[model samples]
Target: MSAVELNPRPVRVSPLIKFTRWSLLGLGILYGAFHHNRFSKIENARREKEEAERPAREARLAAEKKRASEAEIKYLGELMTTNK
Candidate 1:
């Protein structure tokens, strides 16, 4: 009946359980880093590329629209002159 007897039934965790716990922790950290860092950077790059191209795309579209309008006006002017 000494100190050894006092804690004879000390809790012991199984090695398999410890390994599983650590493995899950490592997987969670990997998942978080990939999702928050890698995937986010990829998404940001795509968005930036799209944003950079948007003005050019809009300008091209505006130019096309302007050309179409000018052609229509020219056609109408020719029609009016012929009608007169």
Candidate 2:
């Protein structure tokens, strides 16, 4: 009986296949980074918008308070004048 020798050959990949694989990987990384940058920009814009609106909200509240005080003063003046 003759001893059989088994040698496994190394598989060769084509250059085009390797290039396509690397290109796909690069595109995936770029896509993820692009979305990450976009997300940060959106978060920053939201924060800025909130900051900008805060002063307007405070001003509106202040104006409302001033109007209420003016109305109360006018009523008191009218009552005093009528009683005189």
Q: Using Cα atoms with residue i matched to residue i, what is each candidate's TM-score against the true structure? A: 0.47, 0.44
Writing each residue's lDDT as its tens digit, candidate 1 over 1-84 gives 565585477689999999999999999999998789988899999999999999999999999999999999999999999999
The C-alpha stretches of model 2 lying farther than 4 A from their native spots are 1-9, 49-84
lDDT per residue as tens, model 2, 1-84: 456547657789999999999999999999999999999999999999999999999999999999999999999999999999
Cα deviation at 84, candidate 2, in Å, is 52
Measured on C-alpha atoms, candidate 1 has an lDDT of 0.95
| Residue 10 lDDT (model 1) | 62
Q: lDDT of all predictions, in order shown?
A: 0.95, 0.96
Roughly what TM-score does model 2 have, to 2 decimal places?
A: 0.44
